[model samples]
Target: MSASVTKMVPAAVILFGAMGLGGCATKSYVREQIAPVSQRVDALEAKLNETDGTAKSALSQAQAASGQAQNNGQRLDQLNARVDGIEQRMAESQKKKPRN
Candidate 1:
């Protein structure tokens, strides 16, 4: 019985050691599991950068359009003043003319 017990002890130790080592993750296995997630994160970052650039470009264009609109409004106001002066002169000339 003692000889059998001694033999079983070493076999049990070897079996437990193999199970413990098998349960541990290797470096290559960890890299394989994480690679896809890393690639997805990189892709999302790139897309975010592209979107940020587009938003900035749109804001710049809107600001430029707003400046042009203000310039047009000022020109329209100046033209309105000139037209009013011409109308006033025409009215005065009509009043000075003699009836046929």
Candidate 2:
């Protein structure tokens, strides 16, 4: 019995050691598999950040354009008003002139 038990203990120890080694190998393989995915996620996040910056820049440009348009509209309105005043003065002068 003692001889058999001794042989069994060595065999069991070797088997358990092999199992531990296999577990470590599996962990390494899992890490390898996830590495590419992690890199892709990081790249996507960077792209998203760039897109956000572009959106903000576009919004700022749009606001500046809107402000310029408003200024142009006000200037146009003032010009129209001036033209109307000139026309009214010309009409009044024509009425006061002697008939031909």
Candidate 3:
């Protein structure tokens, strides 16, 4: 019984050691597998943040352009009114003159 027990102990120790080493190896492999995915996700997040910033900048520029266009349109309308007034005065002056 003593010989059998001694023989079993070494076998049990080797088995447990192998299991521990295998667990460590599996953990390493899992970390290796997930590392690339984590890096890609980080890269994607950065790109998304950059794109969001660019979109906000574009929206602000568009709003500014719209405001400027509105101001230009108002100025154009005022100029058109002034031109119409000048045309009316010219017509009146021409009508008052007798043609040769």
Candidate 4:
């Protein structure tokens, strides 16, 4: 048991020493890494805002186009009805005229 303790003590001391050195290096590296990620996050936010604006514009245009289509359909229906009425009148007039 004494021999085992002697071996473990040295290993524990070495491990603790290595961890202490690693802790200092890790802090500086983490700080450097965080800066770029923070900048990228800001850039992503700007892009998202731009996308949202474009989507809103497209939606407004689509709504306007849909309204125009409906108006045009009604106008077409009215024009077709007028043409039918004119054709009917011409057919009656032809029947009344004598054969030529």
Candidate topping lDDT: 1
lDDT of 4 by residue, 2-91 (tens): 999999999999999999987775767888989999999999999999999999999999999999999999999999999999999999
lDDT of 2 at 61: 100
In each prediction, how many residue pairs overlap at the backbone (N, C-alpha, C within less than 3 A)? 0, 0, 0, 0
Model 3, 53: alpha-carbon shift in Å?
0.8
lDDT of 1 at 37: 100
lDDT of 1: 0.98
The lDDT of each candidate is: 0.98, 0.96, 0.96, 0.96
TM-score of every model versus the real structure: 0.71, 0.69, 0.69, 0.74
- Candidate 2, lDDT over the whole model: 0.96
Judged by TM-score relative to the true structure, which candidate is superior, 1 or 4? 4
The sequence of per-residue lDDT tens digits that candidate 1 reaches over residues 1-100 is 6999999999999999999998999999999999999999999999999999999999999999999999999999999999999999999999999879
TM-score of 1: 0.71
Off by more than 4 A, model 3: 1-29
Global Cα RMSD, each model: 4.2, 4.8, 5.6, 2.8
True lDDT of residue 46, candidate 1: 100
Model 1: worst 10 consecutive residues (lDDT sum): 1-10
Report how far off residue 60 is in candidate 4 (Å).
Answer: 1.6
lDDT of 2 at 44: 100
